[model samples]
Target: MIVIDEIYISDEVVEEQFVCDLNKCKGGCCVDGDAGAPLTNEELNEVINGYEKIKHLITAEGRKIVETEGFYHYDQEFGWVTPTISNGMCAYGIVDEKGIVKCAFEQQYYAGELKWKKPISCHLYPIKISKSKNTEQQYVNYEPRDPMCNPGCVNGQKLKVPVYVFLKEAIIRKYGEDFYEVLSQIADQYYASKEAKK
Candidate 1:
């Protein structure tokens, strides 16, 4: 782990490779989870307030579920999460003809209908964050979900794209550009040390 201030970062973020192959995984991360995408207090409000805009993009049943049960519900493990459809798909999910699940909010964002570009957690896939048990610190770890992300991992290796590089925008959005810059430097030095030994 690389300790920088209150954040504990996993080495795999800089060492391992990953790039989402949506065609292969069909956006499994969106629909395969136990709960809907993890949401912060702010994100929850954004979803609730922006529901009307996102409504049309989602399935009709999903819209009904969100309307009746509210946008988010309490989860024992994840606290408040976006509500899911009966089959466990996100209420905000829109499956294309190809069966690839996509975020409705993102579709709106790309279409210039919404400003918020989906949730931070959704943006930071493959990189999971948890609060440290000992301290009020955040541990950023690379969580590789095999098979679901196997193609992404293989493609990343082929493309030579590290997790940090793949998730640069999300990391910056969560931790600021200064943190990202420092983290990049740390990654650079770590790789340089390995190269020197080689």
Candidate 2:
């Protein structure tokens, strides 16, 4: 695992899968999401070519999602397209010259340029921020992650002081003390769980 701080979390699981194999896991994200990946303004510009292009592709609900979440996305409840398979392959994934399905973003990077920013929703994958159903404003604990794409992120490695230092300041600005405290506890728990993993 790529531990960012604190004592090392055993790297065995990740070394076997990720130390050198990360790029091979491309196309995993796009294999499913169809509505579109959440994107920031800059990333949107890169992908959709500014206002005119995006104006046509997004739905009305998409506008609301972007306004509140700073990301454009599809609700799973909205349902994915039928047949799941498109031309004997995943709908949104990109095919290589040799016809392998791969991540659309990974393909973007494969070309001459790499678009550095992803939608905030895409950036915070595996680690989700949610509002409780009973009270949309209230925070819910972070959800358990889907292991497929999240396998090597050092979830249980304690954010070392330096790492926490950077994170805490940003969290405080976004949420204040209560949020920060809860988040710190959450981080600890997440790392502890990660450390316990086989």
| lDDT values for all models | 0.91, 0.38
Worst 10-residue lDDT window, candidate 2 = 12-21
**What is the model-wide C-alpha lDDT for candidate 2?**
0.38
Question: Considering summed lDDT, which 10 consecutive residues are worst modelled in model 1?
Answer: 127-136
Writing each residue's lDDT as its tens digit, candidate 2 over 84-162 gives: 2333222224456654455443344455245433233443332233434454342212222345444333333432222
- Candidate 1 lDDT at 171 equals 96
TM-score of 2: 0.36
Q: Tens digits of per-residue lDDT for model 1 on 16-91?
A: 9999999999999988886888999888879977788989889988989998999898888877888888888899
| Clash list (residue pairs), candidate 1 | none
Model 2, residue 20: distance off in Å is 11
Q: Give the winner by TM-score.
A: 1
Give Cα distance to truth, residue 164, candidate 1, Å.
0.4
The global Cα lDDT (0 to 1) of model 1 is 0.91
